[model samples]
Target: MMAGQEKGDLSLVALTKSFATFTAVHPLDLTIPQGSFFALLGPSGCGKTTTLRMIAGLEEPSGGRIHIGDTDITETRAYQRNVNTVFQSYALFPHMSVMDNVMFGLRRRGDKNAKAKAGEILELVQLGQVADKKPTQLSGGMQQRVALARALVNRPDVLLLDEPLGALDLKLRRQMQMELKRIQQEVGLTFIHVTHDQEEAMTMADSIAVMNAGRIEQLGDPATLYEQPRSTFVANFLGQSNLVRAQVNPGGTDRIVTVRVHDTDLEVSREHLPYGVDDVWLGVRPEKLRLGEAGGPNQLRGIVRDVSFSGVATQYAVEMPWGQELIVVQQNDGSARAVLGETVSVSWAAHHGFALDASQDAAAGAELVEDHG
Candidate 1:
């Protein structure tokens, strides 16, 4: 256990970091509630890691304050702050046993019952049976648990996970995602995770901040950010979105706004899109689209350009007349399917469609995704 059992919300006020001429993290204001799983998600060079490092005291902010509840710790050294980071490398001592590795910090501080304290945390991480094992003797997943055990033993006010699962395989990364969430809930400690993987953040975080060019593009619960993206970058970055240039039509009833995409007219919820703008980007997620008849509230005709199967889902690339390829994903549940080189009609409900400012680049985050891969 840690020396101080203090607990409070972590707050960042106008947090900014710059490297001479380059500003890595623009003025950022964020608050992570106590005991919440929050993720800072973005592609490479987006400043998520810089913000995390500043909070961990590994990097000094050029401006602003960091607080745990009401206590300011902006000038605190890395070791002095009640914060711990679980890095991708694990960083376990190879010569020591698992118990010693976990208890090293406590023993160095002269905690008399360090062994028992470490044992309890090891068991909490389901590593009690392997306490005597060396770091070299453990599997990758087991080694990760030992690293987690070492962090949890200290019971820091906030746990920073800097792409801790980046070194694990896809299957094991997913397994650890759940395990990390389970551990956070069981221990009731605030967790700040920084990663470029959208799916990883969605699966593990209670809320996410999508960063782009050192600024937050969007911040909300995973479902809200995915279903009701407010910007072109967010609409494309969170997941695949089919965006088409559109002009807002004059006729709209109460809550619906009409927009004309090419020759087709579609309606979007006013809550999701603004009405005064003449030009907008109509957006819809791939999974929400259905291959159906031409007549519908929001429908478009396109030719199937490509098809791919990945066990649980089938993805189709539908090419529009204006040289844009829109993606559609369908579940493999015995439903009728579309084939390549076939003309098809795609339709979705009015609520499923969203609108983004036409001024923003439609392909804002596409290249970044490819670059990361």
Candidate 2:
């Protein structure tokens, strides 16, 4: 059996990267506690990968210090650091057996128990039976486990996963997400995952840092970020949100604020309102709204312009009297469903609405459609 590995907390202070005239990563400070699964999530060109590379010592920082616990590894070479990286490509040595490939690193490090250590890691990754197989003999998921085993065999203080599941199909990708989480928990190693997939990050990471324009826009647990996004980019990027312009009524009570949207007056929690703003963009998630009679605290009248049905839920686009269309999603329960061309009133609780500064771009999260296209 192999010796237990020491887990180290990772910290970045003023880390920055630049490419001539453009800055890829702005100077930023972040701390990842030991044994936590932290994710750096963002769209392409947002510097998530660049940040991971810097942590792995593959990319020299333009300015910043990287620390693993008390040790400063900012100037250390990639091979000299106590860290390992698993990339999108498995990068396994095809000529060597899986067991041999895993032992190569340990043997190179002068460990006499390389074979035994490799065997233990193989079993840890659930690939013990495939230890004799070649890289080509394994499925995509198995090959990935082998790659992980090779890295973990070295007993690094931290593991960096850079879109490691990008090559797998949807079903396999999801399965790997769960497997990776299990592996991380079993090893208790600090895991820094870089990905653009929001669902994947939310599913596996204990905490996530949402990056945009080479800087972090928001950082929190998945539920906090989803239910109460601080910025328009985060609100729209993490998931769908219905943002409508509204004017906050002055002289409001401390616990609640009255916001006027179109012809409707919505009572929103003061805690959810943007700091020091009279005019704001009210935000609500589609699923949080109920399309029915106007008996709730906040209600709006609209004409059902379109309706689309998926197996699990039905989505409706309702056009308000002021000409703005709002989208609503309802579960496919046995309850009656709204039809197109019908006049309907949608209502929701007072606290369901979130407010942001009116000056912020209403189209902050609009890039998702173009990104997928």
Candidate 3:
């Protein structure tokens, strides 16, 4: 850690970055707890990478202050701030053995026990047996671990990971996610990770900030952001959501507001719709909808347009009367499944939904869903 910068949260105040007419990052403010795993998540060109670069002091902020704990390091150079970054490329020296590559940084600073310090970090990342091998002799995952070991050996106050797992295969990427979380907890260092993969972010980070169009759309724990998305962008990005157009009905004015979707009426929790609005989007997750027409508070009738089976679960694209398709996901647990062209009734509890302002585009983040999933 930088002198006296220990145990203080990383704070960014009024941070901004711009290029000609395009603003990469708007004026922003955020605080990250010390010894925590925080993720900046969004699709490409969403300013997540730019924000990470700014935090690393690689790209100077247009207007803002960066601080570590109580110490202000806004004007400090990257190396002087006690911060290290590990990139996706795993930039290791191919000519040098793993041990020597890790020890190079320590030895450069004239540390007396560079070899011992390097060995300990190598073991922490579970790459001790391969210490004598060159980078070319190792697998992609092992090379990534070598890069992590090299940075951790520096013992920096904060580590910035710029899509560190982007180069790995799908199976290896999942494995590295677990390994990264384990290493973070054991080292007890503040880790700031940037990635466009939603699953990767949710699997590793304790807290996540979802960015869009150079601004933070939402920030919270994984479950909170996935369960109760505040806007259409968050709803579609985190996971699949079945959002329908509805109007707040004046007939049943109770503690919970009732909204009319076509001819059916549904209730949204008062907490969801803090302010009264004439029109709203009733949002519910695909998994929450059941394929039963039985007695339920909320029910909608639709024709099954498409059916997809992915072993774990079956997904049905049900087209409603208004030509809107709502997806319903059902687990394969020996229950009767709906088929294509079959008329079915979908039901869900009223409290399972959330209401958003109708003014927002219903398909705001639709095009980017595939990249996230």
Clashing pairs in 2: none
What's the TM-score of every candidate structure? Answer: 0.95, 0.94, 0.95
Residue-level lDDT of model 1, residues 1-373, one tens digit each, is 3322467999999999999889999999999999999999999889999999999899999999999987888988887788888877999999999999999878766889999999999988899999998999999999999988898888789999988888888899989999999999999999999999888999999999999999999999999999998888888788889988999988787889888888887888888786468889989999988887532478888999999999999999999888899898988978789988999988888889888889999999866765442
What is the clash tally of candidate 1?
0
The list of candidate 3 runs beyond 4 A from truth reads 1-5, 251-255, 294-296
Across residues 271-329, which tens digit of lDDT does each residue of candidate 2 receive?
99988889899999998888895335888989999999998999999999989898898
Worst 10 residues of 1 by lDDT: 1-10
RMSD (Cα, Å) of model 1:
2.1
What are the RMSD figures for all models against the true structure?
2.1, 2.6, 1.9
Q: Report the C-alpha displacement of residue 168, candidate 2, in angstroms.
A: 0.7
lDDT of 1: 0.88
